[model samples]
Target: MQSAELQGILPGKLIHMLNLMRFNFNVRFISVLSLVN
Candidate 1:
């Protein structure tokens, strides 16, 4: 939900792409962490 909001506010420029990429990376990281726990 929060990630989706961030994506909406961000532009499609290079920096925004990086932001979205980082957001995706964080989501994946959290999912993996939860599975590990």
Candidate 2:
């Protein structure tokens, strides 16, 4: 496998991971806000 091929694949994987983290963070933020109110 070439470095070029690996580079092409890594960003898609990283983006997927980031999206999942953002979703979980948003859920926690909303729950915290509700508790404070």
Candidate 3:
């Protein structure tokens, strides 16, 4: 029962983490671009 619940929740957690990483990357990229200009 706990394994089943973990299976359901893991993917959502992974996607949320991926989204946070992407957002941080975007912010860094924009900052670098502004500094160059």
Candidate 4:
């Protein structure tokens, strides 16, 4: 109930936050990969 309501109103904001988190994660992953090479 609450999840659906928030999802309805904040879909764009949620996606933006998720993208930022994924980007930060990818950056960290790449740095670690580079260090191993």
| Top candidate, metric lDDT | 3
The lDDT for every candidate, in the order shown, is 0.87, 0.98, 0.99, 0.95
lDDT by residue for model 3 (1-37), tens: 9999999999999999999999999999999999999
Candidate 4's TM-score reads: 0.72
* Best-performing candidate as measured by TM-score: 3
Tens digits of per-residue lDDT for model 2, 1-37: 6999999999999999999999999999999999999
Instruction: For candidate 1, write residues 1-37 as lDDT tens digits.
Output: 9998778766556677898999999999999999999
Worst 10 residues of 3 by lDDT: 3-12
Model 1: lDDT of residue 34: 100
Better of 1 and 2 by lDDT: 2
lDDT of 2 at 18: 100
Alpha-carbon shift of residue 10 in model 3 (angstroms): 0.5
Could you tell me every candidate's TM-score relative to the true structure? 0.66, 0.72, 0.84, 0.72
Which ranges of candidate 1 are over 4 A from the true structure?
1-12
Cα-based lDDT at residue 27, candidate 2: 100
When 1 and 4 are scored with TM-score, the better candidate is 4
How would the candidate models be sorted by lDDT, starting from the highest?
Answer: 3, 2, 4, 1
